[model samples]
Target: MITYNPKDWFTFIFRFHKADTLRQLAPLIIGISVYCWIVAFLELNVFRLSENSHVKNITAMHTLLSFVISMLLVFRTNTAYDRWWEGRKLWGSLVNNSRNLAIKLNAILGHEEAAHRSFFKKIIPMYASVLSHHLHAETTRLALDEHEHPELKNLDTNRHMPNQVASMMFQRVNRLYEEGKIKGDQLIVLNSELQSFTDIMGACERIKNTPIPFSYSVFLKKFIFFYVMTLPFSFVISLGYIAIPVVAFIFYVLASLELIAEEIEDPFGGDENDLPMIKMASNIKKHVAEILN
Candidate 1:
């Protein structure tokens, strides 16, 4: 995500970040301006409609519909933000669980068990890295170590990567339990964190797979389009040429909100506003290595 100082209002206003909706909206803004100008001209010069004309009543309709549209946009934005925040929370849980698992394994395993230490250290973080790739629909190759462990090499990239990784961790932990490496109580303690890896993965998958309802999304776009297109009809009578900029600004505000909602709703993607999955995965790797090593 694009990080910035929230306190720096002037910088935010003056600088157009790469993901700024203004860039995407610029061409549409110009088109709307030109369209508004034509509408204003036709209404004023050609139709010669007066303020008392029935056409001017459209402004009242807009005033009432503005409340409705604002409510819809508020719901839309909030819903999208909730998904983004939930994704972040799930990843946060993954980070905490990974750390807990590594810490537990460190305490339970003998200091001489370098192989087990190496496996847990690499595999815990590998879960996060693999989940990140899984959500983005990329190959789970980046997380693979140069000297990959023999057990991890059996992972079928064609299958669900996060599940395979989780299964591997569980199998290894179970083996440790069977071998009397970890006691019954220690197994129970480790179970929660190990299971949480899959839980977190499932939650992330829900967010990545399900999207905002298609009809609702389509209706919102159409609502904005029709609402903005009709603005000149409402304002042109009294405002004349000035209505062009007024309508354009309104469209800009409404359209920008939709654009932001769209970008953030899928927090796993490459959008600048998306959750920092790669960085989080790297942090998990670093922290797990620190704990296990």
Candidate 2:
């Protein structure tokens, strides 16, 4: 994610980055401006649509549609941010649950079960790393010390990596139980943390797989496109050459909102507006290791 100090108001307002919507919207803004200029010149010099009563009706239509678009954009952005926040919360749960599992393992098994305790602690961060990569559909070949986790090198890449890692965790819990390393009462507590692992994984999967409905998104795009394209005709009739910048600014506002909503809708991606999954997962690893160490 792009990080910068908001030194002054001007810098913050004009700050440009790869994730900024202006890069994508610039071409469209220019097209809209040129179209507005043409319409203004034609209506004033040749066709004289500016004085027509129809222009007033069109402007009135735009005024109403602008309100509707504003409301729709609000809902879109809110929904996107909700998904983003949900992903962050799920990661937070992963961190907390992992820490809880580690603490309990250390308390229950302690130095006597050092080898087994180390297994779960090491794999905990592996799950987080693979889960982050899984959401982004990237390959995860995270290096692991073979002595710590023998199965780490053998885990099947064909299967869901997070689920596989969780399965290994559950298997270790069962082995400990079979050997009478932990009592049933302690087993119940550890199993609960194990379940939490699955729960967090499921929650992140839901947010990653599900997206804004196609119909709603498409309709909004089409509506906004028509609205922005026709906007300059009426605007130019009223404001002449000045309407170019005015309509361009309007296009920028409307398009920027849609672009931002799109960017944030998928919070798992590596975009600036997306959740910092890499850093978050690393932090989880570091903290869990510190606890176990």
Candidate 3:
């Protein structure tokens, strides 16, 4: 995601180039211009329908339609933002819970033996980092070269990648129990932490798999196109030549907003506004290192 500080609005807007924005908006601009020309030709010559009374009625209808469209846009944007924010919040909880689990594990197992303490310290962060890597694979590949873990290199499985990593962690936890480093109760507590990781993973998966319905998206696109096509005819008599660019700009803003909502709706993807899973993993490494040392 674009990490904009509160004071960086000027810089943010100046350099704001999302390639998807151009891809979505280009066709919209072309369609609107072509539509305006067609409407202008018909209104001026063939129909001669650019009278004041006709314009007034069309303007009233456009106003009502614009209000309804604005409401739809607002609802769509709000829903997308909620999904984005919730994903971030869930990850935030994962970070906190991981740290808490590490601390608890240390308290329970640290006193048993220095070797066990070191092992738990090393493994907790590794587990969190692996989880982060798994979550981001759909969006971007994990930079294994930069954050190389010998343990991760050895992992090979045909099953789901994240689940495999979780299984590895569980096996390690079981080993700790079998070694008599942790009591039965401590094992139960560790299992709870692992369960939290599983829950977060499931939540992210749900968001990734479930999308806004295809019908709603199709309807929204069609409505926007039809609305822009009809706009110039409504304004040709009143605004004359000025109606062209005016209608184009209005369509541009509405289309851009819709494009942004779509991009952020699945914030786990490789979009400009997607969650920074790599950065989060790095932070997890740092925090884990601090605790270990």
Among all candidates shown, the one with the greatest lDDT: 1
After superposing candidate 1 on the true structure, give the runs of residues whose Cα lies further than 4 Å from its correct spot.
143-148
lDDT (tens digit, per residue) of candidate 3 on 105-149:
656755546654555555565555666556556422333432433
Give each model a TM-score. 0.97, 0.95, 0.85
Q: Lowest summed-lDDT stretch of 10 residues in model 2?
A: 48-57
Residue 263's lDDT within candidate 2 is: 85
Worst 10 residues of 3 by lDDT: 139-148
- What RMSD does each model have against the real structure? 1.2, 1.7, 3.5
Prediction 1 global C-alpha lDDT: 0.91
Residue pairs of candidate 1 with colliding backbone atoms: none
Error of 1 at 8 (Å): 0.7
Q: Per-residue alpha-carbon lDDT of model 2 for 1-293, expressed as tens digits? A: 66677667788787787877889998998888888888888877787774564775688898888899989999999999899888888888888887888888878876776787677667888888888999999988877788666667778888888888889889989899999889999989989999998898888889888899999999999988899888777877678789899989988888898888888888899888788888888988888888787
- Give residue 154's lDDT in candidate 3 (0 to 100): 54
